[model samples]
Target: SFCPDSDLIRPHRPVNPAAASRSHQELHKELQRLSQEGKTELQRALEKRKWEQRMKASRDQEEAKKSTSPLHQELLKRHQRLENVLSSHCYCCFQFLKLRQIKQRQLLSIDI
Candidate 1:
């Protein structure tokens, strides 16, 4: 029977060049995979930075819009006030013309 304590045997070296070539090929494939993974991570980081910049720009535009909202309302209010004043002035002009006509008619009746 084989010895029960023989589990510590050293591994045998390959005798053919084919086995060495296979190991080299495997190592090359692993290096290429790691390089590709690193490139992908760098690409992801770049995209994330672009996304952050776009979000910041959007926030700034929203703030600018909000700041101008009150100014727009104030301009509308001023326009309405000007419209009211013009309407009142037009009405006053009409009343003045009517009074002038009536006064002229009264003078004609007295002279006749």
Candidate 2:
């Protein structure tokens, strides 16, 4: 039982085909799980990119609406001045017509 050559007399265990098949199946399942996880991560990244692009476009549109040019500002000021001038001119014309009517009435009363 204590022979120095016992290591040389022990039989080598043969490779089992069933064990190899089981390991291959486990590896296949693991690869499938990793692939599914990678697909999910890729999908999340794509969704985030789309959301960011949409946000950027929305911000650009808002900035465009808020931005103004010197020409536009000048035009707006000119439009406002024209409106004021028209309103004042119409008011003066209305006052002038009322005064004319008042004077006619006064002259009629004096004649009576």
Candidate 3:
């Protein structure tokens, strides 16, 4: 049917077969390379996650062992004792400083 607006619709250009084939081959190769790279990246990420899980499990196991060990208990006890001693020493030093400050103030008042 001849329509008045028919000239607006342009005719399709005949595609070159050789060029089409080459374009298809290039796209296929690019797709294959991308697929391989994606698979390799996925595999590496999985391996890294697995390694992290294994490390966490091993660390938890070691911590559990240490918590139940006699040596660790002794060390914890010693640390508590040291903390107590240091706190007591700090209290004594504070008291000595207060006494020294009071004596200096009394000496200043006497001179005035």
Error of 2 at 10 (Å): 53
| Among all candidates shown, the one with the greatest TM-score | 3
lDDT of 1 by residue, 1-112 (tens): 5575888666687687754698877977876786777665467779899999999999999988777777798998999999999999999999999999999999999999
**Inter-residue clash pairs, candidate 1:** none
Q: Candidate 1 deviates by what RMSD?
A: 15.6
Candidate 2 clashes: the total is 0
Tens-place lDDT per residue, model 3, 58-95, is 99999897667788789989999999999999999999
**Per-model C-alpha lDDT, please?**
0.85, 0.87, 0.87
Better of 1 and 2 by lDDT: 2
In model 2, residue pairs whose N, Cα or C atoms come closer than 3 Å (at least 3 residues apart or on different chains), thus clashing, are none
Candidate 1, residue 70: the lDDT equals 73
Q: What TM-scores do the predictions have?
A: 0.40, 0.46, 0.47
**Candidate 2 wrongly placed segments (more than 4 Å):** 1-61
Candidate 2 residue 24 C-alpha distance from true site, Å: 27
User: What's the C-alpha lDDT at position 108 in model 3?
Assistant: 100
Each candidate: RMSD: 15.6, 13.9, 14.6
